[model samples]
Target: MKLNVKKFENQLLQRLRDLKISNKKVLLAVSTGVDSMVLLSGMLKLSKVLDVEINVAYIDHQLREQSKEETKFIKEFCFARNIPLYVYRWEKEEHPVQSIEAAAREVRYNFFEKVLKENNIEYLVTAHHGDDQAETFLMKLIRGGNIQQLQAIQSVRIFREDYQIVRPMLIFNKKEIYDYAKQLGIKYYEDETNKSDDYQRNRLRHHIIPVLKAENPEFLKHVLEYTQQLTNNLQAIQEVADVKLNKISKEETLDYNKFVKESPLWQRILLERYLEVKGLEIKETQVQQILAMLNDEKKPQAKFDLNEKFEFYHEYLKIGIRIKSTTSLNLEENFELKLNQWHNLEEGKKIGLFKINEIELMPGDETLVVEDNENWVIRHRQPGDSLKMSFGNQKIKKVFIDKKIPSEQRNKSWLITKNKNEVYWILETKKTDLSLAPQNAKIHYILVFRKK
Candidate 1:
């Protein structure tokens, strides 16, 4: 087939202009594959016409034996064309045992980031075409997610604060890229692993995508058109969602009572935007978990672990995402219990010992009522301390073990005690018989714990 060389070059040149990457120092992430080779060749041609500064970055992952040959070819190609090249060889010893593909990608991007920063490049150009976008869209669709996940492979996005990553080749399909490279006599190496069905993408590429294309000749074009449309729609939705979120959200906290009034779709959009602003990826399960926690009428307060470092929590009318604190609270150390005052603890935790005549409690407030003991002290678990339960005196250690409280958390959990070594309340985890105030008791105390 005869290739429309000028048409392809013009389209790429226009894309560069549209992304505003023309006449700027841009680094090309090349892999000596057809798609990237076409990108490199096209950019070299455009550099002369548009006065764009071209630099090449190639990560020799060293996973395949052909990497050595590819590296030599790229070196000679760059030298002959008078283009600057940056190459890094990822040693086999450094490769991970599992998820090697993802790990290699991380390493490759890290290297590209280093090169871009050291060389002061403004844009990192990549060769992700329309076919890749279609595959990614289908993959995420099968996996299930919100619209943001369905919309794949952005043509231009922020790589960091100032630098941007641009994919001009996204305007073309995979076959167009290969044909362009062939017509221009651009030397490229094919990755054999791309044909293997061991990877999901490869499986799609070999079996599913071809079948889809066979059914509809313009599948890639339609996919690209839909992707762009989705991108535009998301921008509009995000603008509206941002406004809605700002009204109900304060810092990391959201007024969930007000948030629940919005439509379910809007709620999802708002939550997705909220996490995006906080730089957290929202998984489908996480979104459902958070929504269930927020909407559950029975459970006034609940928490879901988003990851090891972060958590989503709903308390009364408020819900929010926060970083999980690693602070260890010493239960053995006692603090002077001040009456009628909220004592601040580590990680925005608060405890109060208030003298009250009537029992009044709010949702999410863990309270324990006991006979007024002027000598009450606030502390965590201690040796030989036991909770006075209905059946018998249960060891504080045994209570924690029975409750299945994690050891790390058992040490950090707070407890209210009086008369030394008598555990009155195990905070939110449990309430002992000692928590009940005597019927004729003149004085009563309510120990409350809250997370701000």
Candidate 2:
């Protein structure tokens, strides 16, 4: 089939327009392959019409003897066109067992990311066409991947916080890519490894995809549509999950009862999102295992080790890193309770005492009044510290036990006192309304805690 250069150029322009990359610096990942060469050719043509700046990058995997020659050819090609070219050579590492394809991809991307940061490149472009997407989908599907994974390649994806990877040629098929390259008279070296059936993708491309295409010439088009639909559905489901999760999530815990009441599919989704926010990863089986632990009636207060770094307590579904207790505040020797100012506490926590009239108090925040001549000190709990509660005078140790504050945390907990006789405020736990002020008290203090 003859390539319609005008049609291909129009398509390329439309894709770039949709990506909103008209004036952006794009680093194109090019191999001496037909797909990449055609992409380079198309971009060169678009450069005349658009304001986009393009640079080429090539990674020599060092797996083939001809890789050196292919790298030289790409360097010369870019030089002839007056385009900047970056070349990275892979360094092999000794591992007991490794997938060469996966290892090569990791090394190539690490280099690309480093270059992007060094040069302030906004977009990393690759020539992943429709056939590559289909092969990826089929491989992940056969390997029992979830819906999101089955969708495979995306047109544009965030590579880092502000950088993106774009596949503008994903709208084209392999045959169209070859035709376009041929029509432009672009020279590209073929990778013999691509034709070898040692890799699963190669086996699919050489053996399975042809038979499927023979049965239905438009099989790939349908697959692309199906994957798009799956992507849309996954996005919608994620939106709903996010809304529900936000409603029941707290700073350090998930509402266990509400999370358990959700449907199984939503439970999985919510857990996945929660873990993602925590910067943790859990497999499907681990998710199920956690749910089972939550549902187990015999162990109402069970604790599960998520990994070396984290632990999950069942009753409240609190997931947090298992960190050592902070050292004692040692307030007896060094610290004093300063009024009307914030004090820096251990562990990025801050405490402030203000007059109730000085700041509007939120609900659940405690307020109190103190005598003018009273002296106060901020200190960690002592052996016999007691707080005057609504019920009566209660030992601070009893309060910690009743609230189920971890033993490690209790050792580091802070307390405020007007005298050595009574504890008035326990930071982050509760404050005692010690009605010890004069009838017309002139000084009121509000103790507040905040994270830095």
Candidate 3:
């Protein structure tokens, strides 16, 4: 088959232009395969027409003995053409191998990121064509992925704030790439592992794609078209979801009530977007666990441990980094509180005793009058300390459980007391009539807590 090198070159150049990477320095991930070789050829030709700097990057997994010969061939090819080449070899023995494909991909991309940063390259180029996209779609579908995951591969993906990965040949199919390489007489090495069915992708490529292509000659073309449509639709949905998410999301917490009212699809999209913003990639089970926690009316005060780095709680669906309370103040040590002065209680927290006549009360602010001339001490909950309520004396731990305070917060919560015999007020919530001011007291003192 005759290859349209000019047409291919124009299409690739147009893709790079569309992605706004036409004149940027791009590092090509070349594996000496037909697809990569064709990509490299097109990029080399494009360099002649445009002011784009193209560099080749190759990673040898070292799984097969033939990789050494392939590396030698790639080096010789790049040397003859005077193309800059960066080669990385996998230290198989140094790293423990588990899940060969996943491990290789992780290592390969890490190397790519390092090369991109060290070389000041903005774009890392790869030769993932339409067939790869189709195969990925099928794989995700069989693996129970959602709509977003089904449209996984994009033409251009922002790898980091300053770097991106671009696939310029996704418009072409595998057959077109192979024919282009053959017609141009490009030297390339075929990986023997690709023919084996050890990997799911290999199975799909060898068995499923061939059967589907035989049934419909333009199967890959149709799949690519559908993927494009799906991508557009998902983008539109995400825009709407973002608007909803922004409405309920604050600096530290998301309003659970508003989030729960959204449609199930919007809820999933919003939650996924939230996690993505936090740089977390959660599994479907974990997403479901979060949704379950949100929807559980019986356990509205539940907390989900997302990972070691973060925790999700149901108090307005607060998602934040896991923080353990370091300051555990024991009430055994009594500390005096002076009137009209603020005292540091813990990090970002303080308490003050003020004359009620000097300050106005806000709607949400809690105030308690000083009962007698005795000195008040600020301390955390002790074993015997309980809040004096309308019904009876309730244990501090029970009060915390009733108020649905998270355990981590309960540990650091403070209490106000005139003596060990009675508890006057809890820092944020509970209060007793013991400190309530008389109907017409001449002087009133107020206990207040402030958080920075």
In order, candidate lDDTs are 0.83, 0.78, 0.80
Q: Is candidate 1 or candidate 2 better by TM-score?
A: 1
lDDT tens string, model 2, 1-452? 58788998899999888988688888999988898888888898888677889998899887888988998899889999899999988754532256777777887888888889889898999999889988998899787734568888888888866789998887888888888877778888888889888889999998988898899988888887887788888789889888998888777778777877888878778877777767776566777788788777665455666776576665434433344324444545425656677778768777666776786656554445566434666778888888878788899888886786765567678787776557888878878865656678767555666665
Worst 10 residues of 2 by lDDT: 316-325
Candidate 1 TM-score over all chains jointly: 0.74
Q: What is the TM-score of each candidate against the true structure?
A: 0.74, 0.71, 0.79
lDDT of 3 at 36: 92
Candidate 3 lDDT, 308-419, residue by residue in tens: 6567777634544344334555646656788777788657677778887776655555667774435788777778788887678888887777787776677667778776
Residue pairs that clash (backbone atoms under 3 angstroms), model 3: none
* Clash count in backbone of candidate 2: 0
Q: Can you tell me which runs of candidate 3 are displaced by over 4 Å?
A: 1-6, 283-289, 296-300, 316-345, 348-408, 417-421, 428-452
What is candidate 2's TM-score against the reference?
0.71
Clashes of each: 0, 0, 0
Cα displacement (angstroms), candidate 1, residue 145, comes to 2.6
